[model samples]
Target: MAAERPVPTHEVTNQVPPVVGRDISTSPALLEGLRREGGGWAEDEVRALALLGNSETWQQAGRLANDHPPVLHTHDRYGNRVDEVEYLPQYHDLMRKAVAHGLHGAPWVDPRPGAHVARAAKVVAWGVADAGHLCPISMTYAVVPALRATPELALQYEPLLTNGVYEPALRAPQDKGGLIAGMSMTEKQGGSDVRANTTVAVPAGDGSHRLTGHKWFTSAPMSDLFLTLAQTDAGLSCFLVPRVLPDGTRNAFFLQRLKDKLGNKSNASGEVEYDGATGWLVGEQGRGVATIIEMVNMTRLDCSLMAAGGMRLNVAHALHHATHRSAFGRRLVDQPAMTNVLADLAVDSEAASAVVMRLAGAVDRAMRGDEAERAFRRVALSVTKYQLCKRLAPHTVEALECLGGNGYVEDSGMPRLYREAPLISIWEGSGNVAALDTLRALGREPAAVEAFLAELELAGGADGRYDDALAVLHKELVDLGDPEDLQFRARRVVERMALLLQGSLLIRHGDHAVADAFVASRLAGDRGRDYGTLPSGIDTRAVLARAAVPE
Candidate 1:
């Protein structure tokens, strides 16, 4: 008998290659978006982003997010209440790198044209690596404007806030070289309704107060200080709560428990009880919502920008895997069906990046005292936040599917990206809340709506599909009917508005192939319900090449 051939058991076939160690900042879509929005970044800022992209440390941060989620320590060995949250060494390493790069407070420290845009781009890049640590970073960035309401407080804290150092010690703000801030605005009863908050703050005779309440969601609870909301004699008010008093003693902040969240696991979010926690009122007593709104608006913009960054990374991973993996004797990316899907994803990512960069530019100009830019920002922020954040999950799911079973495994890193995708939409504000905010913007600031529409009109004649979409949006705005009717259609209006804006941005700034594919598929209804359904005529290969990560 012929000798039976020994079966080879070590063969690994059709395995998708790993996607890492590439410069994320040099992504073609990101570079193009930066250039089109405004090429105002200084050489150092650009170099910083490049370094972040190439750093193995930053890459490790991404791994650490899944491998080492934060843990809460509620008590000491002797049964003393500690209320501490412990993170892995990698988390602190990531935080130190982010702080050293000035991702937290550079824009405010060095005020200049396009400063917010520069800072926002850095946040986007950092978010691609690990988003959880950005909670404190973003709060620190947002708190500056709200702190300005009280000059004394601003003077005492602004330097610490912008010091470009990561001091995680629980001590007095004055003693620390740098500080990170968190926020606790929502309780169990009130999620987005700040007025529904019932936390109480009693006067302490001095310029301070003692807070006694339970915050259902205190994000980054270990921060040096927190900006929280509480009811006072006047009304609901914003207060700056310190973890430690000036005497270097811990405040009466008690951690009840930490939330078991779906994603963003690297950060700690806790249910905290303030048993006479010392706090100082910020702004006026009755205007808590108004004061804290400054912080909320900035965070909302970041929600959109970070979502865009996440989407870009998702597409990059999908394309990289597709190009390297093979089936039926051909690379997956070269296959026509896979090519269409990747091209559609690439278009979505590029358009997202473009719109967010434009929004960041608006924020920059608004900060520079441009009233027109401010007006544009008022409406654009909500619209972009609603649109981009909502797009993240669906786009990420589709991208993951491109990798088949490999993407489903934890080792592939696609599962983590998929898990984190929906968080942006829920955070800052959910979809319905954002939609209503857009409606409120239209009603309160007519010029903001006009500014939004005017920007969309800039690219009207460039594409017939975009022009058609714009016309429909205009008609809906004019014929919005009664308040109830408008409320019922708020999401529809916001979705159309976002698509129109993205279409305009692509037409004006993107390459012809990408712009045409976006308009044809999204605005012209030449696509299906799922991704990778773009029409045959679109330049799928060109779009894929433009968004693919470099070797």
Candidate 2:
């Protein structure tokens, strides 16, 4: 007999709820798969891999996107807003479909059967990419489903969180969603540099503020709700400016014009001119950057996975074409050269998929209230997003070429995938920022780094693959600051530490297809020589091997 499902309390207010982060206790069949087909990878690793493959959370997202058609908000060709009246019904249907799809899937309903929650998240990522809607609706929609560790400051966002913000905005003929949405925040003078943003947010009477600024690349031009980045007395902060007022009214959030883009034709990317528009603050004064980062961090992984899905789809199409389309008598799949290309494509896609799933598992674990797990998961997520998104465009290009002349044609569907792939890397802080984030994480958790190394040592068992890699990485880190060149030493230490932690996990895990994974991180010991850039620090190697368990 099947196990009974757990009852969950539905809270649709300021506090964003997290996806169920329960422990896995079922699925003997899947557990058997891990033991058999996982190719020597650890049990944790196997479980993590399965999370994205069969999660309920992602299934919901996919159903919603597939069900909803694109809704145009701004009538102007260049604007990027969704018409509130026309879009709400579709949005409601989409959210309901997502929720239903999720509930229907297992593991999400019962973690023991498999990693259904993780799989569902992946499905959602893919669906979002396929939908190609420029509306920031997803941005709002995503937060409420599973609030997790986010702050409860935005109680006003409760009504909006229900996927019902469009209702009142659609009540009237000229009603826009909120106030300022789909406005491009980037400028020609400063780019995405928030510190240099010239948008001025001056206080106005009636507890509102006027936003006067010029922004480029307004996505979803018809959005009445504009969330813009501006300079405040404290520094850079985001303001919630509406084209309409709080009492179901319209305000002065104006549009300058829209810009033509290479792709996303169904959507408009425009330059926006806000002529002293009324606005409300999002967080603390001058802390917009931090608030924005919170949103960006959550979504960056989504973007990366989206790009991965597009690449996967593109490659799948090409592989199918090669099998069916004939060039010289036999099919292209029959050609050894074409087959080799497909093999390489498959390998890349599978590897990318594995890493993305693992990262998602980490996020899932973190959301379930594990602090140590959360820190590493966040770091790993950022790195995976950076690496995967960067690889996506190249992978798609290769797949398109494999499809030959047909790939170049618009009707082939390869062009759309190719067009959307690059944005993953460009948006969400780019490659450099991502790399730096990885490096920064190492700086924060030196002990976690040590603990990870110790786990590798245990998994390695003396002179195994894990042992050899761990030793080399450890040696490099130990001797990194000997020359004492400050900046150079700091960089080397970070690089070595990152390599050490990453190599350790890979070695210990060995790419297992999983259901629930926890990378073992033993705390560092109190003894041993200090090896970081800072001299005279406590040595962490011993701590890692004999670190005490937390109470």
Best by TM-score: 1
TM-score of each: 0.96, 0.64
Instruction: Please provide, for model 2 over 388-487, each residue's C-alpha lDDT reduced to its tens digit, 9 standing for 90 to 100.
Output: 6776788788878876887898655567767777877776667666666655555666755554445445545522443554566678645534333533
Instruction: Please write out the lDDT profile of model 1 over residues 151-241, one tens digit for every residue.
Output: 9999999898988899786877899899998888999998898799989999999878999988998889999888899999899999999
Model 2, position 358, has a per-residue lDDT of: 49
RMSD of 1: 2.6
Off by over 4 Å in 1: 1-8, 36-56
